[model samples]
Target chain A: MTATDDRADAPAASIEDRALALLARTRRWHWAEAAFWLGAAASFALLPDSHLLLTEIAILGLFALSLDLILGYAGVVSLGHGAFFGLGAYVAGLTSIHLTAEPLTGLLLAGVAAGLLGALTAPLLLRRATDLTRLMVTLGVAMLLYEAANRMAWLTGGADGLQGVMIDPILGRFEFDLMGRTGYAYSLVVLFVLFLFARRVVTSPFGMSLRAIRGNSLRAATVGVPVGRRIIAIYTMAAVYAGIAGALLTQTTMFVSLDVVAFHRSADVLLVLVLGGIGYLYGGLVGALVFKLLQDGLSAITPQYWQFWIGLILVVLVLIGRDRVPALWRRAVRRGGAGA
Target chain B: MLTILIDGIAYGMLLFVLSVGLSVTMGLMNFVNLAHGAFALVGGYVTALLMNRAGVPFLATLPFAFLIPAALGAVLERTIYKPLYSRSHLDQVLFSIGLVFMTVAATDFLVGSEQQLIQLPTWLQGRFDLGGVAVGRYRLFLIVICALLVVGLQYVLSRTRFGSRLRAAVDDQRVARGLGIDVGTIFAVTFAVGSGLAGLGGALGVELLGMEPTFPLRFMVYFLIVVTIGGTDSLTGPFLAALIIGVADVAGKYYVPQVGAFLIYALMIVILVLRPQGLLARGR
Candidate 1:
């Protein structure tokens, strides 16, 4: 009730108090968000056979969410986010094969590994540069990693991909089965937990600083925000998110392929993020759901030539203008509210 | 070593011709046309189809290859790309990438996934030894044609009336428009010409780079590298960058084939880190 009640007392409140109220308002969960999560949970029971597909949606959603953190929130354009994702996957695969098969531990290791790589690479991305430069560097780094993996055939299994990955059960309870039920549940749980963490982070004061930086870095710097450091932090955090998503894929599928780090993976995730909408926390989740469904449907219709349609949709979407999409969505929502 | 250098120069020249068009579009309009390779693919396909199916000589098909993609580029510029010039870089990137995907899929559907080989005339097929450096007749022809193109492009860009107008347009579009320059037509023409050049390069490079449905996606990074490293301001930067990349790539492949494209990518990252703008970028 604090969110609803604070607006009534806003006029008399001090500047700090009003800021607190605004923050609280943003932090308040909407009914739609609750319903979405509830639906995700409900699907576990309602759509038992589609758990495998749902699991892919969950991982992709997380991956897209990671991209959203930088591209959507922080205004950083990256073309090779799959670098961290692939790294996480490769790390998880190696850990399962060479060390332990414990799922949580593998996830932790993957996240840490990706985070470290992100931290190391953050400086390279944080330099005074254009978006094109960022794209080339990010892409170049990913390609370098791909080539390295391809060369280190002894360790990575080369072009054939790293196989023989064995993942243990979730907390030593349920075993992974052929139907992928456990995988879906496990991935969903990880996604939900991470989503909560991301939501909390984005709603905080630091997140506001990121928004300010995104809007105008020069002005943000003049306002006493450390633009460079904030970018590095958010980028590293996003990398961890992507890495965790990759780790989930490896854990569920028990195989890591070169395609994980392929250029298409990066492009696909970008498309998903764009489809779901950007900036908002739920965009990735929504986008992943829509993208996966679209891919499935399109492939079903024309397995080989589905990319043409996907490309057509992207072209049409952009031609219509991404800026117009939110306006249209808002209009529909307003009309729906009136009907309700 | 000499043979590698010759091959490298030939490869570099081919890359320059393919990527120079991209540099102009990116520099002048600041539009990130990631689908530039698609134009090249069209040219390559044109050459292959003409040479194989129609029994046309390779030389005759080259003009059609250029003209067709040039027309395609002009139409696309006026219709699809013109509106996007004012959009954000992200939008431009996505739009072009969409074009790339469409072209790739469409090419695959039409031609199948196999690489298309263009039969070079008998005269252009054989290799000759020049001062102990073995050189293919096709490669030498490529180097000669591309070098001529570079010279011609430089002359057109620097010494011609249209070149100065294009330069004016690139420098300050608003001012150029105020000074009675039709910026839109200039852009459309430049874009078409760039696409035509790319087509020519694709036609010439089929034997060397190979032609496939995924041609755009495969060589996209290389084209981007040339533009970024060459600096989008002038023709010389991309030309030089292409040559450096060409030689380095050839030498790298020859000396340490296992390392593959890793060295070139690492070098690009280092260069970008060192000079964020480019190797020969003009002062803003």
Candidate 2:
């Protein structure tokens, strides 16, 4: 048949029609988004008594999300993100102790300090491509900070850390209670606001540029993206977020320890991101929840075996196919449908 | 002043022993094994346990100390590291970190959290007078052993077939593979050897620095700084970097006690900024 005749006879759609159809088919993602938010809100509301745990999860979730910005979006692997976190916490603690004792002011100071530090360090740290070099540079930075903190005992309180930090109420209303009721609410609010901001940044044109850079920096640079500038900006943003999270932690606990910048804290943040799945914004929050829950539950059950079990979990996660969760969930849904 | 220099040299030697293996693996395989320090800790702990608990002679325990960490490294490579080699650096990092946690936790469970001291044998215990300066015999022996290892490793890499293969693999894995060399075997063998060296360093250096459960985290930064500043792919870089860092660290601790703690990191930053490729580029 002639081409025109064939086209007339065949009930085929145009490219635009196909595109529209595909968009319609994928619109159900909106419902999935709604379900996720609803579940999160419900969980938050229902677990009112779990303020301590929830607050911790909130702060850590924010910290992990900050890491996700650089690692997941910008392709910078750091083992020293905790430096900013610890710096923020210490700044907040010192501010509260020696300055105004206001939580909001402390957090703002923390974020600004951390952001400046990240900006300053980015030029040198962003010069490397190999992950090993990046790891060492970041670790060295963190260790340097740790040593400075220890040596500057008069200012940082050394190994004792900045203790007895008393934070006043936010806006002179929400006092931090011993039960962590106020702390949980404050952290949750801060986390949600930051999440919203992060979501905006990630979905923005700038964030798309970051994703492009992450996928292939050489190609992105060839395509006219200023790779260095994007990296520095994203790195600074991540550091600021980490700082806020750290401030939240110190303000909530009313104490700041050198542990904030410790190696284990860095490792823990990495673990949470991995457990939650990198590259997804929700991954950090989910990973934090699961990790905190596991840590809390396992520690209660067997304090000594807590790390052992966590290590086992990490090992199993690594070995049993890192992408098994989505695959298994899909399979389970199919199986349920078939059974029904 | 003389004593500080002597102490710095001895400390530098110990650092060289711990960092050289890490430098080789980092240079050759491009593997970031965070568990490298864990092996060192294992070596120290095993040596200490044998000597302190089992009543084994200090000299006799050396073989066991080296062998135990070597076997551990081999087993770890087979089970955990092998799968991670081809994965992304992030995956490898996470997996190695898990390995570190498991090793540390297991060690803590098996042994207590208390620090264990390594008492040198009588012959290695006393101090020797050198030019009116009395230096510890153990430190002198450590310095000598470390020097020998460096010299021997340089020779092996320069002259031997295995070393040649390793150098080839490090320089260009794809080309080495094209040449029909078993890249996987080379990687495994290199990792084992690297870990064994870490263990040896740990056991030998225990007299200078006691072993503890927190040893991995405590010294991981030191080794990393050396490797980073010296450049990862150069064997001689870590050696030279270690000496600089060792001297700087000891002198900083002694003279400028205020900023002494952060001297190494400062040195690292300065070196990295000045020579980003490290002090030594990998030899062709």
Task: Give the number of the best model, judged by lDDT.
Answer: 1
Share of native C-alpha contacts between chains A and B (below 8 angstroms) recovered by candidate 1? 0.71
Off by over 4 Å in 2: A1-29, A321-340, B282-284
- lDDT per residue (tens digit) for residues A218-281 in model 1: 9999999999999999999999999999999999999999988888888889888888788888
What is the TM-score of each candidate's chain B when compared with the real chain B? 0.98, 0.94
Give every collision pair in model 2: B27-B233
Estimate, for each residue in B1-284, the C-alpha lDDT of model 2 and write its tens digit. Answer: 87788788888888888877777777666777777889898788878989989889887887776778878888878877777766777776777778778877887888977888877778988888898998878878888888898899888888999889988988888999999988888777777777777888888878776788768878877887888788866577888888888888899989999997687787777676667678786433
The ten-residue window of minimal lDDT in model 2 chain B covers B275-284
Candidate No. with top TM-score: 1
User: lDDT tens digits, residues B182-205, model 1?
Assistant: 988999999999999999999998
State the lDDT of candidate 2 residue by residue for A1-340, as single tens digits: 0233345444678744554454454332444455556766675678878889988998999999999999988999998999999999999999998899988899999999999999998887666566766776787788888888888899988888887799898899988898788898889889888988888787666886898888899999998999999999999999999999999999999888778878888889988987787886776887898899999999999798678777778777877766665355446546766775
The count of residue-pair clashes in candidate 2 stands at 1
Tell me how far the alpha carbon of residue A98 in candidate 2 is from the true structure, in angstroms, after superposition: 1.9
